[model samples]
Target: MPSLGADMEDGTLTDWMVAVGDSVSRGDIVAVVETQKGAIEIECFEAGPVTDLIAREGDVVPVGAPLAVIGEADASDPNRTEIQAPPADPTPEPVTSRPQDPPVPSVPEAHEPTPIGTADASMSDAAPQQIRQSAEEPKASPAARMRARDLGIDLTGISGTGPGGVIVIADVEHALEDVTPARPLRHQKDAMRQAIAAAMVRSKQTIPHFYLSHTMDAQPAIDHVTRLNADRPPSERILPGAVFLRATALAARDCPDLNGHDNGEGFVRADAVNVGLAIALRGGGLVAPAVMEAAELSLAETMAAMRDLVARARTSRLRSREMTAGTITLSSLGENGADAMAGVIFAPQVAMVGLGAPHKRPWVVDGTVQPRTVVTMTLSVDHRANDGRKASQFIAAFETHLNRPDAL
Candidate 1:
């Protein structure tokens, strides 16, 4: 299983998108793993034909465990050894099997696709039966299965719209709309809360956190946005949050100290600034899915990314990379939120930038007091990876970017 997050030790393999002999390329969504967070679409990082399906559906494999073997076609060996030994039982038994293919070259560890995690004994006991039922049941995506299960909908009667008659989440949703009223999602909020709490606790225990706050003049940014959106439709107008994210991304790019994970060994700066946006789910828990290469995206692109990220996050449709690729994080309380609030640092990530609600405040501009739109920004840094001086410089760069919205 790919380490979806620090708290995710294992996940249940809910569905496999590719079977034996299917060709897959880098970035293809090959599988789906159900975790405390939700069903995350697992992406393939290697390109080739899949040689074997090692971990079957319903198997709760640990992180770094091989799910399948993708190998070069020109390999001479036809009976390649299994990539790794299957999990010891009480691990769920396979419900079905595929014809074995010729032995293929082993995928390098660095290129191996991360799969799902191990579940508890209770889940293991239930897995075989569930897998057996699913094997004979209607074809459906993992998200669709979870949705149908939660809503008590029968899958056999519903027609799938996905590729090759595979049911998707939308199909499940459509079934609900056609029959019963929509119900609240049966998300594991308590479990999610526990996971979040554990990660935070680990961060607090191991990471030495230092904090800094700065109030920025937001009138320039507000004016710039107003002018840009003046002729556009309401749907096309930009939110101030995007501007803040852009500034934060640029500042992170400029200040390397604040832009990467501290891998226990030392501070490793990221090649690109992937800014993780702290989005609160409608149910209860929170997720910070990154807008990959934020520094390279234009203002409009950043806004679009934020909107898409939030929508997918709430629906539990996020990809595995989005869960794990964040180098730094940003938490923002919009226009109606508090004037200022300090945020906890998401560990491994050396810093987090918090943006409070922008409001009018008395300020001295050229020694004259005036009401200016202002925002309180807070920086939480890991003392081990970054000191007070470097943190201060990051905050200063952030302020400078916000002031010059045109350059953001």
Candidate 2:
């Protein structure tokens, strides 16, 4: 179990997509773990054959716990473990008189306390259970078994259609339709809240932050997006959010102070602008997954990426790498939202940029006062890494990008 976030110390293994002896490659999703953020598919970082499975589905264990061990690929090992047929018997033996040894069970070996969920298939006592299961006990995960037990549903007759002919949680959920509609659980929300609180407290204690706010003319960017989307389909239409993100990434070229992290030694600038967008989850929490290499993408590409990121974040389907790789964060209040927003800095990354809803405001243009569309942009930076002068340059560069919306 990998630590999905700073506050997540443990997670529950919900499902295993691969089985013992299965070949796995790098980036293959091996299992799904239920953390405070909900079910996240865990990817394998190595390429090998699965030799041992130490954690079973629905087992809650601390971070860094071994879920499975992938063994080096070797043809000889399979041959060595292969069973051979018994030599021909000289005389016919009576089946009733011959005694048979039970199949050896493969129990999970753990350094920590055993999780109270389903035991691995290898860990099961095969003999007695095999005899009893002749009535066709489906190969179901521990969580599915627990659900069946709780729901008073029989698994013997239901045909399993999961990987390797196993029964999964979805099978149990399908059974749930006959009884009651399954709503999202509440405990996950509470856990997410606690995790957010812990992270915020840590950030506030360690990072010395300073704030800067500027009111930018929003009409130019708004008109640019409006005209660009005028002919495009609804799905491909651009939004003001994309313009803000693009401008931030482009502005970092002139003022790189906002695009880096502090590793206690000193400030280290990132090679690329990976902007993290603060997205709110419907369940009640916030996650800022990155738009990797945001500076390299086009305005339309950024909008598409933002849409996908927000969708995945809300669905609790984000990947491990996406969760940990943000350089700087961007938070925005939508239309009808607050006039301005000042946000806390997510640590390691020294800065956070926020945008408020655009509204008509009085502005003097060429010594004449007139109503203009404007938006407040606020930046939060770490005092240890950069000074106010650099921050001002960044904001100026950002405003210039917004003004030249056609170039964005």
Candidate 3:
């Protein structure tokens, strides 16, 4: 139960990707926890052999609870305790005919306990036999499960190609090719909406928010994208949204006040501008996963990252870090969105930049009126962390970057 977001206090351990004795490296997906948002792949932060599984599937654990224990490679210690095997059943029957104590399973020397999720260590473990017996609900990646559900395909029939016989998204797609498409299943959008509502309510109640809106001339960015896309293929062409994102990232970099998290005690500025892109899910929910280190990425790179993030978010393939690493957020309405819109400040983040649909408008230019593309940019800021002056400066810097799209 990693803290996927501020609103997440606990999560249900939906699946396990690794078992005891399995070697895991940093960044490996060890388990999947279902938060209110959705199923999130929990990555391993330590490297070594897994010595214990503390949280079993279907166990609801809170954030920072120890979900497993990892051990060092060396196992020469004489006093080392043997690894405790997962329980065969949640409640085992009492045995009256036992003659002696059962032998404990030997394992490598254990290191510090690694906190993965919140659960009582005494809780019943998911035994290996139990894991195998539950073949009707086969092991699959979060993306695979979502895809299978959407396609109305049973995971029990498909063979897994992923490590430890875990079904992946590719396998689901391959299965789909052999059969007709079924009606897509409805997602748990109600739960997601409730989560969003709770977070927004908390944000409003805790943070003093002030909003500022600026309408900028978008003709330069629009023209620049057009010229750049003319020679490129459709797949490689950049959209105006990318330009806006890049501009926001750069502006955030220059204006420190607008680009960091708000700790309860004080403000902590972030070194890298990780811009969280607010993407609406297909069924009717939203997720904002960051394009990590966006300030350092090129315009094309930013566009690619945004596309990838959106695609992964829709399929419930987002990692734990992506869900929690946003320092500043950007919400865009794209070309078909409303002319102007304001967004709520995502808790802990100091600022949120909103981009409205770009459209043609009459503007005075050099003593004469001219029809030009214009976009309304709104900034919602935490007043405790920044005032109106700082917000205006950030907006001004953003406009400067947006106007000079060639430099992005």
Off by over 4 Å in 2: 20-25, 48-51, 71-184
Per-residue alpha-carbon lDDT of model 3 for 252-313, expressed as tens digits? Answer: 99999788876545577887888989999986989988888999999999989988888888
lDDT of each: 0.73, 0.69, 0.71
| Residue 284 displacement (Å), model 2 | 2.2
Tens-digit lDDT track of model 1 for 236-316: 788999999999999999899789876545687888898989999876899888899999999999999999999899888
Better candidate by TM-score, 1 or 2: 1
**Candidate 2: how many backbone clashes?**
2
For model 2, which pairs clash?
106-122, 106-123
Q: Write the per-residue lDDT of candidate 2 for residues 218-281, one digit (tens) a residue.
A: 8889989889989999999998999999998898766887787765456778788888899988
| TM-scores for all predictions | 0.73, 0.70, 0.71
Best-matching candidate per TM-score: 1
Candidate RMSDs in order: 12.1, 15.8, 13.8
Question: In model 1, where is the ten-residue run with the lowest total lDDT?
Answer: 89-98
The candidate that wins on lDDT is 1
